[model samples]
Target: LVHILSHSGLLLLRAGVQGLSYAYLTALVFLHISREGKRVSLPRALLTPVPSVPSPRRYMCSLSLFHYSEYLVTAINNPRSLSLDSFLLNHSFEYNLAALSSWVEFTLEKLLFPELKQITWLSTVGLLMVVFGDCLRKAAMLTAGSNFNHIVQNEKSDTHTLVTSGVYGWFRHPSYVGWFYWSIGTQVLLCNPICMVGYALVSWRFFRERVEEEEITLIHFFGEEYLEYKRKVPSGLPFIKGVKVEL
Candidate 1:
């Protein structure tokens, strides 16, 4: 940032910083909500807190297990699940890349074309994309409820049935759909055209591989029901029909 300031006069870095800030805020919101450990109407829950029946206990019990416990859950389920670790890691990678990409693009564009300037409309559109994309991805997670665990299991528990409602009604992988847009939005919000393209390509490739692997497991678990679901609903992109099944 100091180097960018020395070259590009500081305002150029703001967009990059802002994009990173949004990612941070989104992560914090998700983490806090997820840790609260209940699947309820988040807005209502936050706004209307229930009075405690018992006195507030002064306790921090580390021994008590939580669903979001990464290590323990990983132990319980399949560690090989790409949905568990890889997707989250990819989420971080996408944001980090946007932060760097935006900074680099701004500095270079400013230095290379000192007279020319980035268009205002691009920034406006980028901002909208970021906001909308974030909402879409987060909505998918919340809507899916218990069916939306971090892991992709070969053998699902009795309680863990397939989700085909909510956003899942229109798309097979709405979270992935949300993420695809969000990843691209991060790059665009930073006004990094090259990185935006790069993000799209990389993310699409990963989603392709991930969907193939995940759907095979899904088919095994859900049987013909999953096949019917796949036949009816598009996987990622809405217009994309006839998605090839690997297994």
Candidate 2:
């Protein structure tokens, strides 16, 4: 009886961990899909002023994980009927192979650390920082990108009014701020010293690029109005100035 209970407990723990992993994976995918759909559906005028609506498909897909969890539970309950190793491998192969390539690479590297003794905590932290920073930066970029329409060929640029509400009210580039925090947080959480240097370099490069691009575009479209606004408001960091302009 004790042996049977011990085996059951171990199986339960494995099933729980596997289910949690799938839930997280599903949520991340759903979020990405939703963001993409919102970007596609946004109107040019409203892109500047309001939040975009994510797609229904993302919600539906995320909810489908419950069905997957049920299957995992059933499989766990009938260990003799199902080859657990083969079942897990097959299910993961089908569900996560393409969708989680980066995660797989990271996991493999960690798993093989015993063979590669040089892999220190600092290195892991650094990797985590870069990953987190990039993710945050991308999220902010998408948020800003969805709201602004880029006109590539027009010599005479057009500004779609000033955006001083929502995240814009705090920082001229909320996306950059988000990215900065993400990179820092990731590095700290992962405790990777090597990742910190890489994160710093990556953060600086992207920050400069994004700031220049945004400022140039704003200047071209808004002209003196944007210049004056820049002077009044601190660029990059969020420090709201009491300056108001009639756009």
Candidate 3:
């Protein structure tokens, strides 16, 4: 009996340690992504002259493929950004810490108690969900380029053009949806109640804010044309009947 108790205690300790490690790793991922938005000021001597305005078609076609490629690389390397808050609570440091703690406790309890092993399936599902969600997100990001900003605080680029092809044709906010799913997937894989709740709150907040912000910008830039597109395409959910609007 004493040996069994000691083994149980050790298992619990290991679970707690694993939980804390996961939380810290996740936090670091978010921070790494967020820091990329800081703009480095170039010397005035390095500034290039702006060219005269060309026709819209000519301008669109003339955009350097190299510039787009660079943006894609930057986005992939630093994907999290300020949007981490959207996946976490508003003032979530304590909550995240709590989640880590709870996860550890739960993991420990499961190790000692045979009944807790049943929940392992849930974590497995979550792992699969996260993997699938990540693939979708990467695809969307590759298609969206600079139009996709993971940082909520950054100003939307003024140079954004109306992109109606690829994933954009199916859903207005595919990337955001991908992000939402990704968070859900993480919580599922971790199988922590605290993380699940935190994930839900953060995902909802970010999705709402991102949709509203993008819509406002689209309206401002595209005006009637955007309205028409919004009418036909669903906002977040894919393949649903969209609201009809006359441009």
Candidate 4:
């Protein structure tokens, strides 16, 4: 940041410092939230008030929610299988790439063309996407209970059952639906046009493949039951039709 300041100006320095601090604080909050010694019930934890984060920092809030919700929701629904990896927000290489790209685009745009970064309305829309997407994903996880897995299950377990109630009734892959929007939303929050487009395309392709792969296993597990559910509920992602079935 100091080096950037030498080349740029005090404002850039301030932005860099602020960004780092926000990230650091978010990590701290997560560590505190997920401390090994203390475990709180999901309901109580949900009721706990989170401190209000400022405008741009809401991006951090959304990110934090994205990570911690995965852990928390799974802990509630699939406690026996819960692990740190459940915090999928921080672990994916693709996720890190997307985040880095957003920061890079924001920084370059901020430096080269400051006025381009002032899209307040766009940021607002992005924040809405983040909130809605995150909430919807969490809801699907909750609805699925033990049925949800961060990884697609190739073999059905004794406890694994088809989920077709609640959010599942509305969308065959509500979790993926939520994630697809959230992935794109993060880039929008940063006002990174390039990352926004890239995130959307990448996320859509990834989910498209994932839903198809998972559906094959679902059919194997539940056959007509799964096919019937598929017929009724849309995949809920734009332009994704899941595995093509000849019926």
- Residue 40 Cα positional deviation in candidate 3, in Å, after optimal superposition: 38
RMSD of each: 15.7, 19.6, 20.1, 11.9
Highest lDDT against the true fold, candidate: 4
Sorted on TM-score, best first, the list reads 4, 1, 3, 2
The whole-model lDDT of each prediction reads 0.53, 0.43, 0.50, 0.75
Tens digits of per-residue lDDT for model 2, 1-247: 4644455446546778764654454344333333433533212211222222211222223223323332333344333433224223233452343224323433454476533324344434433443444444344434443243312223443424665555555467655665565544444333334454665565566566657666766677778977666775555543323233346
| Predicted candidate 3 versus true structure: per-residue lDDT over 18-66, tens digit per residue | 5354344333332322213543222111121212211111111111121
The residue pairs that clash in candidate 2, if any, are 122-192, 122-193, 125-190, 125-191, 125-192, 126-192, 126-195, 129-186, 129-187, 133-183
Where's the lowest-lDDT run of ten residues in candidate 1?
54-63
Counted clashes in each candidate structure: 0, 10, 3, 0
The C-alpha stretches of model 1 lying farther than 4 A from their native spots are 1-99, 114-117, 238-247
Per-residue CA lDDT of candidate 1, range 35-112, in tens?
Answer: 245543323323332221100110001001111233223323333331223224334666556556655775686688
Per-candidate TM-scores read 0.58, 0.40, 0.52, 0.78
* Two-way TM-score contest, 3 vs 4, winner: 4
